[model samples]
Target chain A: MFDILIRNGKVVDGTGARAFLGDVGITDGRIVAIGPELQQEGRRVVDASGLVIAPGFIDPHTHFDVQLLWDGAAKPALEHGITSIIPGNCSLSLAPLKADDRKTLIGMFQQIEELPPEAFTQAFDWTWEDFAGYRAAIEPALAVNVAPLVGHSVIRLWVMGADAQQRAARPDEIAAMQDLLRECLEAGAVGLSTSFVDVDENARPVPSRFAQFQELDALCAVLGEFGRMLQIVPEFYDTDITIARIDQLAELSLKHRIPTTLSPVFDNRQSPNNVPRTLARIEEQTARGARVWPQMQTRPIDISFSLLRPSLFFARLPGWIKVLRLPVPERMIALRDPATADRLVADVGEDGGERLMGRLVVRGGGEAPDHLVGRTLGEIAAERGEVPARALITLSLENDLSIGFLAANGGHDSTERIGPMLANPLVHIGASDGGAHLTSFSTYGDTGYLFSEFVRKSGALSLELAVRKITSDTAEIWGLKDRGLLKPGFAADVVVFDPQIIARGEERPAFDMPGGGMRYVRDSIGIDTVLVNGEVAWSKGSYSDSATGRVCELT
Target chain B: MALSLQRRFTTPEPDESLESLAARSLPDLPLDVAMEHIRGWNLHIFLMRRPRGLLLGGDVVFIEPPQT
Candidate 1:
């Protein structure tokens, strides 16, 4: 008897093939059979009529490293049909650390990913040091399959100790790093992830940046031994540097004979040639038989923040960042001080932040007035006869510092421009930044947005092609086996969704973090059910207490 | 299957200072002149990143002048 049967549904199969009416049979967590009018008795049957049954989405870039220890399903990620996640991207992970290094690593995570401090202290036990120990800690609690990448910064920290951040490694330290990378590869890490652009809490470049080219080459050689993948976050601001990094990655890929990818190739209207030029480089590398996939997110860049915490929106403005990073009393004092306010206003530019902070829409949060909810700060500031920066501060102070603001469509907004780039065969559709920018934006709904905007609305890609992009394409890029397809003998990780209505729900604040912190989350709109390894992980707008997920082993 | 086309460039030689490397790569120019041109050409590395002009093995040190 089959364990479960998904009956009478349109199966897309994650192969970019034509969809057909079919029934999929599952047994012992594998899709045993898939065809029309399948005759099999099942312990449970899912009525997927009028829904599209496709392979479960594989989110390639996420930072669910710490969150998966507490919320195994990765919360709304699983609910939004992401069954397999590749965490530990951009040179940060939660393993291969000494107990003394916990505070340091936590600070990196807090600074780079914007995770609250209580996320580390208040939830779950940090009992792991090596990759195997880290895997063991989260193995039993996983509801979404994880194919983790061992971070390069952590590996450097494990080997060179304090010197990892100070300077380039010695020859012996490089050898030690190679050995540690090999150990991590053997212990179920799918690849190695590094960064050229991330900074720690003190605003210093992360340890991975300190490693010279030779050190990275040594690590990639170890990855080559297992034919694994390598992921990096390049200096994405400058196109020339990013292209240089791409060339470097291409060289490593060619030398090591392993696949490599980089995230967040954003489309900027300012530098229109940036993405095209980078894509041109990628194309050249691909022509040279080097696999260099550039991962791009489907959603527009919309940042929402309140004065309650230090947000990425204010990252460049040092005074605002310092004030927001402080405790409530300190932040209030800084905001109230006229001298400090004047300095902050000066920092906002000569127009008194009219150009930068003028268009920010006041998103009514706790205690904010209803009348000012949807109005721009420019409009409100003019009424008060105050500069936008000063007005923003005054408004927040009036609301007990709980009023939220949204900076929408900063870039990556033009559909006509971004559609063709997304449709490019070389562009890997990912970089959701899930579980990291928890408070800044809803990272869980990018996949949904891809379907809603690209597939259904703009017709940039057909539904089948879009499914393949997130499923098989992502799985192939990350080297995840058996989880991205819905065929016989494959893992029955699947999602049933309405094609017409599939989209991200409203972005709202949810105070569910380890600390009493709040994050903007958008619920999945049209996902009817999600299955991981043939078990129903989510169904009917709720979740099942099933922990069927396991650590993915890369051969 | 059809493939895409793109430009190809090389990095500077090992242990070569930016000036000499630029002189060798851009041979028609003088050493100091070549170094100034190189710095101007690659502001991303020469100015933006710290420890300015610290070239790596894999850096894309451009040899040509600005196209536009």
Candidate 2:
């Protein structure tokens, strides 16, 4: 008997092919047959009559490295049809870490990813000092497939200890890093990731950035041996620097013969030419037989933050971050101090933050008055005859600092402009930043956003093409073998959803993290069922106890 | 797409000295002139770097000055 049968659905195979009526048969965790009206007996049947069945989506960039320890399903992501995730991006992972350096890496994660402190200490046990040991720790808990990349910073830490962040590596140290990277690849790491942009909690650059270019090249040589991928987070905000990074990646790609990717490539309306400029370089590189993929997110930037935490929303406002990072009583004292308040007000810019803090709407709660709940800070400030920054501070202080604010559409929101760019063959759709940035924004549902916004709304990509981009295209890029397809003998990871209704739910706070910390999340709108490796993991809007996930084998 | 205007560039050769690399990358220019131009173009190495101008094995050292 067939293990499972998904019948009578519009099967959009993750190959950009036209959607057609078909039934998929799964046995022993692989797609055994797929054709029209298959007559097959099954232990369980999923009646996917009007839904679209496609390969489970693969998110190439994420930081589920920490979250996966506690929540194996990478919650809300699995519910959103992300069957496979490639974590350990941006030079951070939990493995290859010495017990002594765990505090250092934890601080880095807290700083870069904005995860709360208890996420590391309160959630799970930290054992194992090697790649294989780390894998063994989380392998059994995962309900979604993982193809983890070993981080360069951790590798450096493993090799050089604290000096990994101090200076250039000597030749002996370089050779040791290469050997360690090879060991990680041998232990099933998909590749290596480094960062030129991230800094640890101390505002020092991450260990990878401290490495000279020669050091990176040496590590890439190890990656070259396995033909593994190389991922980097470049200086994405600057056009010149980003292009320089692209050129660097192209050179590495050519020299090492490896696939390389840079994440979180954003397009702002202010510079419509920016992405085009970047993509043109990517094309130039590809023409010369170099693989350089730029990862872009589908959703616009929306930052949800409150005065209660040190959020990335206030990252630019060092004064605000300083005040928020303090103990509550000290924070309250500083906010109430007249001299500090004046300086903080002055720090908002000469116009008193009309440009930056003008559109901030006061979200009423805790100590906020009902009248100011939906009003802009500008309006309230003008009513009170105070600068917007001052007004924001005074009001928050009066209300016990319980007010929340949202900075919506910060950038990457130009649908009319981004549609064609997202549809471009060279542009890879990714950079959801899932499972990190807790309380900052929701990184879930980028795939659904691609369908709802790009496919149904903008007509930039058809349903088939959009699915292909996230599923097969991502698999092909990452060299994930036996996944991202539904052909016979391929892993039977699949999702059934109503394309018309598939979308991201409204962002809301979820108190699911350790220490009861809140994270911003969006519920999946139309995903009905998700199957990983032939077993139904999520069905009819709820998750099953079945843990069919495993560490995926890369080609 | 903007082209990389400065065509004369080479990766550093095995901990090459800055002065040597400057001369090798800009063979036509006088030693001092090439060295000055190299110093101006590579503040990331000469100015901001911890050990200024300590060239590595994989650096893309540009010989020509700015194009724009």
Candidate 3:
């Protein structure tokens, strides 16, 4: 007897083939049959009439490592129909750490992923030190399957201790790292992830960046042993450096015969050819039998921030970031002091922030006045007869620091330009950074946006092609076995949603993290049901208590 | 599928600093004139990223004059 049967739906199977009317039968957590009519008696049956039933989306980039320890479903991601997630990207993970190194890892996560310190300390018991133990801890609680990548930074820290970030590894250290990587791969890790551009909380480059080219080569060789994946974050700002890194990755991929992927390729109107040139290089390497994929996100860059926390807006401005990073009272005092405020305004520009701060729109949030909402900083500054930067500080001080600002469409805003690129066959549709960049933007609904914006609205990609991009294409790129297709013998991970109405919900601040930390989140719209391992995980805007998900193994 | 449609151009060698690079890539102008044109052309880098004229190994370093 089938465990579940989803009947009467348009099945857009993940193979990028055309959709057809069908019913799917599940048994033993696998799809046993898929056809026009499947005569089966089941323990439970869902009437998915008028909904599109397809393979659950696979998100390729995320930082759900710590969150999975506490919220195993990965919350909003599972609700959005993502059954499998690739976490530990950009060289950060939770396992293979000594107790003493907890603070260090916490700082890195805080800096890179914007996770609060209490998330590591207050949420879960820090019991594990190796990849196996970390896997064991989260296995029982997971509702969405995970294909985690062991981080290069964590591996270096495990082997070389504090010296990992100091300099290039010697030969012996490199060998030790290779052994550790092999152990992680065998312990259910799907790949190795490294970063060249990320830094720790102290602004020193992460340990992975300090490693010479030889160290990474040794690690890639280990990945070759198991036919696993290698992911990296290159210096994306500079196209030349990014292309150079692509060449380096191509060499490693050719030598080791392993797939290498990088994120994120942002579309900048200022540098029109940046993304195009990078993709061209990727193609050149692929022609010579090297597999290099560049992952791109569908969402435009919209950053919303308040003085409540350290934000990406203050990233390059060290003085503002330092003050924002301080405790509330100290931060307020620093902002109030004339000397510090003068330095902050000076940092904006010699024009006293006429250029940098003028474009920020007053987004209403956290006790902001209704009058100021939707007004630009430039208008407010003109009213006050002061420069935009000075007006921002003066206004915030008056409001008890409750005002918020938004920098919308910082780049990647032109839909007409981005639509064709996203629809390009060679472009891999991902780099959502889901579960990271918590405060800056909502990464949850890019998959839904892919359908809403690109498929339905813009006509850039057909429904079937868009579904395939996030499912089968992602599976094929990552070498995930038996999960990304709706067919006999494949895992029964499925989503039922209305194609016309699917999109991200409104972005709102949710204070659900440890120590009352807040993250901007968007709920999923138009998704009716999500199933994992043939069991309902989300239905009708609520989650079931089933934890049928396990760590996925790459074959 | 054709991957991209961008024309790739390489930065000239060292001793071929910005002036020499501009003169060679845009040979119609003299050295000093070419340098000024190059500076005016690529303000996004030469003006934005600090140490204004700091050249890296793999920089785009455009040689075209400013767009009017």
Q: Candidate 3, overall lDDT?
A: 0.84
Note the residue pairs that clash in candidate 2.
none
DockQ of 1: 0.22
Which digits, one per residue and each the tens of the lDDT, describe model 3 over residues A187-206? 98989999976778887667
Deviation in angstroms for B44 in model 2? 8.5
User: Which sections of candidate 2 miss by over 4 Å?
Assistant: A303-394, A400-402, B1-68
Candidate 3's C-alpha runs over 4 A off are: A305-395, B1-68
DockQ of each candidate, alpha-carbon based? 0.22, 0.20, 0.06
Task: Give the least accurate 10-residue stretch of model 1 chain A, judged by summed lDDT.
Answer: A361-370
Candidate 2, residues A175-262, lDDT tens digits: the string is 9999889999999999999987687887767888777788898888888898999999976765555677788888899999999999
User: Total clashing residue pairs per candidate?
Assistant: 0, 0, 0
lDDT of 2 at B38: 85
Clashing pairs in 3: none
Assess the local accuracy of residue A499 in candidate 3 as a C-alpha lDDT between 0 and 100.
Answer: 89
Worst 10-residue lDDT window, candidate 2 chain A: A361-370
| Per-residue lDDT of candidate 1, residues A1-555 (tens digit) | 799989999999999999999999999999999999898878999988999999999999999999898999998899889999999999998988888888999999999898988999999888889999999999998999999999999999998888788777888989989998888888999999999778788876788877778888889999999999999998788786687788889999999999999987998787899898899889888998999999999989876778888887877898888888899999998999999989988888889899989999887434669788768999999999999999999998898788989998888888888888988999999899899876667788888999899999999999999999999888887778787888888888999999999998877668888977877678998999999998999998999999999887554
